[model samples]
Target: MSEPTAPQVPAIPTARRQALRQHLMNEVTRPARRPQRMLVLAPAAAVLAVVVAAGVIAQPWAPRSAPLIVPVHQGEHVGAPLLLNQMAVAAADTPPPGEGEYVYIRSRVAVAELGDGPARLGPAYEREIWIPRYERGDGLLRQPFLELPVIGVIPDRTTLPDMPPNAEVVDLPGDPDELLAKLHRERDERGRGSSRDGAAFTAIGDLLRESLLPPPTSATLYRAAARIAGVEVVRGVTDAAGRRGIAVARTEQGRRDEWIFDERTFEYLGERSYLVADTADGPAGTVLATAAVLRRAVVPERGQRP
Candidate 1:
C-alpha cells in the first residue's frame, strides 16, 4: 500500500493569529466570588492591598469596622481613561500563578431571545486549559462538560489556531498606544470594515474576558481599551449573576456591548450586550448575551474544578 500523505494545515493571517492566541490563554484575572464555586484559595493577605487600593475606602479615623469603600451611587460614571488606568494598576499588582499548572474557569451564560421571545439561560460550565512552560505546540484544552475531548495535537495555526498547542499568549506590549496600533493592524489585516473604535473595543473585551494574563499585560489591555472611540461609562448595569456594577461600553451596529466591573473596587465582574436600536430580528432593548465569570484558578491537572 502507498504511504498516506499528511494533512495540510492552513496558515492564519499573521496579525489575527497573534490575536487569537492572546485571546484564549490569557483569560483569568482573579478568582470567583462565592464560596461554593471558589476554585483557587488566595491568601487574604495577598488581595488585601488590592481590595483597599481599588475599592471604596473609608476615612482613616472611621471605625475599623467600616467597609472598604462607599457603594457606587446611582448614575455614577468613570471615564475610560480613569477606569482603564485603575484596572491596569490593579492588574499590575496581581500575582501570577506558578508554572506547570492548568488555568480553570467557571462561568454561567445567558443567551438572549432575538424575536420577541424570552431569553434562555445556559447551564454553568467549566474550562480547563494547560499551558506548557517549556513545550511548544503542546497546549491542552478540556471542557469539563459534555465529555469534550482533549485538543492541541494539531500544530496548524490556521485550521485550529484558536486551539493551538502552544502557550503563545505572553509578552504582549505594555504600552497602550502600541497595543492599539497592534489591534488596528490586526483589524486591517482581517479587512474588517467596521469602525476601528468598535473593533478595538470588542478586541479589548475579548482580551479581558478570555485570558487571565499577567497583571502588567492585563493593565496594558485596559489602557488600550481607553483609547477606543465612543466608549462610555454606564451605571447600574447588572451581570448574569445579578451583581450590579458600572459598565464601560461602546455602541456599534445599534447594539451596546459592555464590560462590567464591581461598583466599589472596580474588579472585573462580567459582560453583557443589548440592543440600542431595533434590528431586523429583534426590537430595541433586546439583550443578546450576558455572562458572569464565577471563578478562575490554577489547578494541578485536568478534570479538576478548582
Candidate 2:
C-alpha cells in the first residue's frame, strides 16, 4: 500500500495577518515591568524564530516606534554655571583607571522607539560595559535583556572594537576652553546634529557616560559644558532608577537632554532626555530616554567586576 500524505496547514488570511502585525507592534511598544534578574540573551536562531513567528521583517537600523507621552512636571530654574561648577569639583576627585585596567559601568536605561505609530517608550533594561583604559585595547558590552525590535536581538555579551561607541578618545585636554574647541571641531568634522553648541553639549555627555576620564579631564568637561549657550539647571528630575536629583540640561531640536546629579552630594547620577514640545515623534513632555548609573569601578579584566 502507498504511504499516506501529510496534512497541509492553510495560509493565514490577509485580515488576520494585519491584526497580528498590529498586535505585535503594540506589544513591542508596551512598557515592561522591571526584571528582577538578568535574562539570558537569545541566540541567533531563537531571534530568527521570533521574527518568523511575528510575520514581520526585521529592520535593525530603522525606527521601531514613537515615544510615549508621559506626565509633565515643572522644575525650578537655577543657575547652570553654579551647578556645573559644583559637578566639576566632584569630578576632580575621581581617580582614573590604571593601565591594563577597564572602567566598568552598570546602568539601567531606556530609550524611545522610533517607528510608524503614536510615540511610546521602550522598556527599561540593564546595560553593562567594560571600557579599556588604553587605546587599541579590547572592551566588552553586556546587555542581557532589551526589547529592541528595531535593532533586532543583541548578544548578551560582545567584544568591542578599538574605539568603543561614545568613547573615542582616551586622553583629553584639562583646559576648559581647549576642550570646548576640540569638541566643536570633532563635531564639525563628523557633521553631526543641528547646532554646534548642542553637538558640543551632547559630545560632553557621551564622554561622561562611558569613559573613566582623568580628574582634570573630567573637571574640564563640566566646565566646558557650562560655557555652552543653552545650558541650564532643571530641578525635581528623576532618573530611570527612580533616584530624584537636579539636572544640568540643554534644549535642542524640541528635546531636552539632562545630566542628573545627586541633590545632596552633587555627584553625577545619570542622564535623561525628554520631548520639550509636541512633534511627530511624540507629544510634549514625553520622556525619550533615561539612564541611572548603578556602579562604576576599575576592573583588571573585561569580564571581572569590582
Candidate 3:
C-alpha cells in the first residue's frame, strides 16, 4: 500500500467564514429568531404545558388504569358473552319438618343475560337437575315432603314477585293427590307468569347476585373463591360488592391471556375466543369476554357500557 495520506483543509474566504459565524451568533442572541410560526405553535405549546402541569398535579395525561375482570369461571368472554342456556341447578326447599332441609334442584332452566344488547348474550335453553333420594323412614308417615322441579323463562326487562298463599276451600276433590298436583302446577305457572322470569328465575337471580356482590371477610384468595361458590367459608375478603368470594378461574397448564374490560364499570374483563372478522368499516366482532356478578344484580337489559 502507498503511504498514508494526511487530511487537508480547503481554503474558505475569511468574509464568508465571518458571515457564517455572525449568522450563528445572531441565531443564538438575536431575540431567539422569533420563529416565523409563533402564532401557529403557541396553542400547541400551551396545550403541552397544560398537559405537563396536569401530570404534575392530577396525572390527567398519565396512562389510565388497566381493566378488571374477576370471574367465578375462567376465560372471560372467550367462549361467548357470559350466558348459560339451560342449567339443572339445585335450590333449597323444605326437607324433613323436624330434620334438616335437603336441597331441591330445578330440573330444567334457561340462564339469563348479564348485560344489555342482543350481541352480548345468548338465548335461553333447557336444563335438568339431580338429587339424592331413597332413605328409610319411620312407619306411618303423616306429612311426606317432596320438591318437584320446575321450568322457567325470563321475559325482557322484568323482576320477580312473591307467590300468593294457597286459598282455603271447604269443598274436597274426589282425589286429593290429583288435587295437590293440580294445585302445584297452578302455583308454579302463576309464579312464573307474574314476573318477567317467574319465581324460579327470581330465586336463581337472587342466588347469583349473592354470589357476585362482595367484600370478602378477609383478603385471602382462597377465601374469595369460597364466597362465590357459596360455601360456609372462613376468613375471606369482600370484592366491590362487600361480600366474601373466591375468584373462580379457568386455565390449562400454561397460557398467558388478558381480560379487557370497561374502565368505568369494572365489569368483567375478557377477550373473544377468536379474532373478529373484518367488516366494511373495520374488524367486526362483539365483546367476546366479560365478568359478571349475579348478586350485583346489574344485568343490563339495554344500556351502553357505562
Candidate 4:
C-alpha cells in the first residue's frame, strides 16, 4: 500500500519475440498497390539497362579464348626437344652475311637412280653454291673438281622455279604459324596432292639448304620445324661428309627424310633421304639422296670460293 501498484505484463518467449519482429518488418516492407506499378517499371528499366550494357561489352577487343592449335610437346623422345632447342641456340649464335656479298656453301651430294631393273647408286660429287645477298638475284653452282668455268654460272635450280614467288628465303615468314599457313596455301595453289604437313616440312628443308637466312630467321625455322607433327629423333646418323650426329627425321609415304645435326655442337651437318618403301625412284632402304655441308661463308663475288 506504500506505492501505487502498476499492472504486471508477461514477458514474451524467444520464439514469439522473433515472430513479432518478423511480422513488423514484413508489414513495414509491404508495398502499397499504388506503388506496385513503379516497382514493376523499375525492374523492367533495370533489365533494359543490363541488356544495353551487355551489347556495349561485346567488342572486338574483349577477351577471347585461346587458339585451338596446340603446341608440340616433348613426347617419348626426350632428346627431341633438347636437340631442337640446341639448334635454335646455335642458329641465334650464327653470324649473318655482310652487305654486297654472296653466301657461299660447299657440300657433297649423292643420288640413287632406280632403273627399269633395279636401283643403282649414283656418283658422290662435291658441289658449291653461291647465292647473292639480295632477295631476287641469281646464284652460282659448280663442281671445282670437274674443271667447270672459273666464273661459275648461275644454275637454274637455285631459282626455286617450283615454289611460289613469295616462297623465297627472304620472303618466308619468321613466325611458325604464319610459315605453316603460307606453306599450306602455296601447296594448295600449286595443286599438290602430297600431304600438306609433309610438304611443309620438305619446304623448310629446302629453305635451310638452298639459302642463307639471318640468325633469327634460322632459329625461327628450327622452332617451326619442331612444331610440325611426324618429326622424330634419329640417333647415330652420319652425313655424306662422314660427320656423325643425331638427326630429326620424318617418314612419309615412301621416304624417310632426315636432317642431321652435330650431337654435341648442335650445328647442322646435312640432310638425306632413304626409301621407306619401293618406289619408282628406288627400292626400300635405298638412300635416295644425301648432302653434307662442308663450308659456308660470305664472298665478294658469286663464283668466288671461300
Candidate 5:
C-alpha cells in the first residue's frame, strides 16, 4: 500500500499464461485435420464398380434349338421308294463271281447276262440273281397264261428244269410280299417268268448311297454321307439279261456289299459281299453268301391280292 509502486498487478504465472495463449492460437489457426484426409469414399466407389462388372460376363450367343434341324434325310426319301419298287431277289448254287455262301434252296439259278450294261451287278464280280420260276394269278403278260413270264427283270441260264412252264424263280426266297403274287400267277399260268429285274441307272442310282463310303455302316450314315458328296451309283451293267440284286455300296475299307431280293415279297434277299480296290480289276474283297440262306420276305403293295 505504501509506495503504490508498480500498481500491484494480480499474481499471474508466466508459464500458465503462455500455455493458455498457445492452445487458443492452435485451435483457431489449424485446419481441422482436413477431415482426416482419408479417401474412404474412393474404396466404397471401387467396391460398387467391381460388383457391376461381375454381372456382365454370363450369357450365350444364340437361341439353343437351331443346330439339330438342318440336315434332312433326303437321300432315303428319294431312293428308298424307288428301291422298294424295283428291288428283287435271285439265287446261286455254287458261288456267283466272288464268294457266294448259299448252296441249296428250292429254286435253281445259272449266270446269264440278261442285259449288256457296263455296270457290275451284285457284290460279286460275276453277276447273278435269285429269280422265281413259279406263277400266280396276277394276269398274263402279252398272252393270257400262254407263256410263263419271267419272275425277275434279270435272267439266269437255267436248265429250264422241265419247269411247269410257269414256275416262280426261287433264286432269292428272302422276299416276302414283293413279287409273290406275280410269281405264283406267272408260274401257274406260264410255268416260269422274269418280270422285275432290269433297272435303269437313274433307278439304281436313286438307291445307291452315293458310292464309296466309310466303315461302321448304318442306313442313316450312308444316306448322310451320300447326300453330302454327290456320289453316283453303278451304271450300265451289261444289258445281257441277268436278274440280280446289287451290292450298292463300297467302303473306303474296300467292303462291297449288295442285296438280291424276291420280286414278289421284300424278303431279306440274297446278299453279295466283296471289296473294291482303287485300281485293279481283280476283286479286292470277297462274296459272303447268296440265295443259299435268304432272310425273311418284304411285302410292299400292302393289301394287294395274293
Candidate 6:
C-alpha cells in the first residue's frame, strides 16, 4: 500500500493570523467568570490543519470537572485610596521593556471550575509566557496540560503569532481621569461586565496581567483604578504561591476580584477572586481563582530567561 500524504493547507493572511492569535490569547489568559456554555473552537479543517501544523492546539472550552475549593480570607476596608497612590509611585519607578526584547513573566495560577455539582478551584499550575516588545515579533506560551484531554494528546508549549497591542493599554492618555473615561466607554461598548465600574476594574487588571506597559502608563492604570467606585482595601491576603500581600478589591454581583500588592513596597504581586454572597456556583467566601507573579524581566529572545 502507498503511504498517505499530509493534506495541504492554505497560508493564513497577516491580518487574519493576528486576529486569530488575539482571540486565542484572550481565551487562554483570562479567567472564566461563571458557569456558561462553552464555545467550541472548530474552525474550518484547513485553518485547524494550519494551527495544528504550527504546534498549537486550540484549547478546549468544555466544562471543567470540579476540584477542591480554596477558602477566602476577608479583610477590612480602609486606606484603599492611599494604598493605590503608593502603588502608582512604585509602578512609575519600574522601567519598561527595551526595544527588541521580550517581556518574560512567570506565574502560578489556580482557576476555579464550575460544573453541574458545585464550583471548585483546581491545583495551582506554573505558567510562563514570553511577549515580544514589538507587535511584529512572535511570542511563546508554556504551561502544563490541564486535566482534560486536548485532541487526545497533551500539549505543553504553544507558538503564538505576533499579537497586536491592546488599544486601552497602548493608546490611552496619561491623565488618570481621561484614561478612566476611555476605559469606561470601551467597556460599555464591549458590554463586558454588569456595571461600568466593575468593567473598568477588570480591564485594568487584564492589562497588568500578561502585557508589559510603559512606566507612565502603569502608573496611570493604578491611578485610574483608584477612581472607580466600590474600591476597597483587603489586608493579609495570600496569593496562589502563598505569598502574603495587601489587596485592592471591588465587589460586583456576587464575586469580589482583588489585585494584590506588596505590603511594604507596594509592588504588584498577583490577583484573586472569590464569592461574597452565596450563589448556585458556590457558597459565600469560596475562592474562585488565585494567581501569583513569581518573576518578570526583559529577555533578549522568546525563550530566554533573565
Worst 10 residues of 3 by lDDT: 85-94
Query: Positional deviation of 61 in candidate 3, in angstroms?
Result: 40
Model 2: per-residue lDDT, tens digit, 150-255?
A: 3334467766655332133535667889877876776576574447787677667766665566777778888988888888888888988999998888887778
Flag clash pairs in model 4. Answer: none
1 against 3, candidate with superior TM-score = 1
Per-residue CA lDDT of model 6 for 1-306, tens digit only, reads: 995332223456667666665554444533211112111112111111112224223223323554444455564555777778878899889866566467788988766544333555655778787775654446677787632222232356766564442322355578999877876776566564357777677767766665667888888888988888889998888888888988898888878888888899877788888788888757887776778889977777888878
- Top lDDT: which candidate number? 6
State the lDDT of candidate 1 residue by residue for 1-306, as single tens digits: 995332223455667555543432232222211122111222211111111111111112112221111123222234767877777888788887655455555555544322222222233333434433323333354442221011122221211112321134434576889878876776676564456666667666755664456777878888888777777888888887889988887777767778989977777888877666655525566565677777766666544555
Deviation (Å) of 288 in candidate 6: 0.8
Candidates, ranked, lDDT:
6, 2, 4, 1, 5, 3
Error of 6 at 194 (Å): 2.9
lDDT of 4: 0.55
Model 6 clashing residue pairs (backbone): none
Per-residue lDDT value at 58 in model 4: 15
Worst 10 residues of 5 by lDDT: 140-149
lDDT of 5 by residue, 1-306 (tens): 573222122333667545534432222121111112110111111111101111121011112121111111112224543443333211111122222221112211111111111112222122111212232222111101111111111122221112111122122123233223332343344332222221111112212211111121122223332332222233211111244432233222333324333334333333332335432212333221222222112122212111
What's the TM-score of every candidate structure? 0.63, 0.72, 0.17, 0.64, 0.20, 0.74
Model 3 ranges off by over 4 Å: 1-154, 161-214, 218-248, 252-289, 292-306
What is each predicted model's overall lDDT from 0 to 1?
0.52, 0.63, 0.21, 0.55, 0.23, 0.64
lDDT of 1 at 192: 48
Q: State the lDDT of candidate 4 residue by residue for 1-306, as single tens digits.
A: 494322222355667555644433222121111121111111111111111121111111112322111112222345565667678989899876665467777877654432223333445667776665644456555652321111112232332212211113445567877877776776676565457767677767765664567788788878877777787788777777878887887777766778888888777788877766666544566665577889977788767876
Candidate 3 lDDT at 39 equals 9
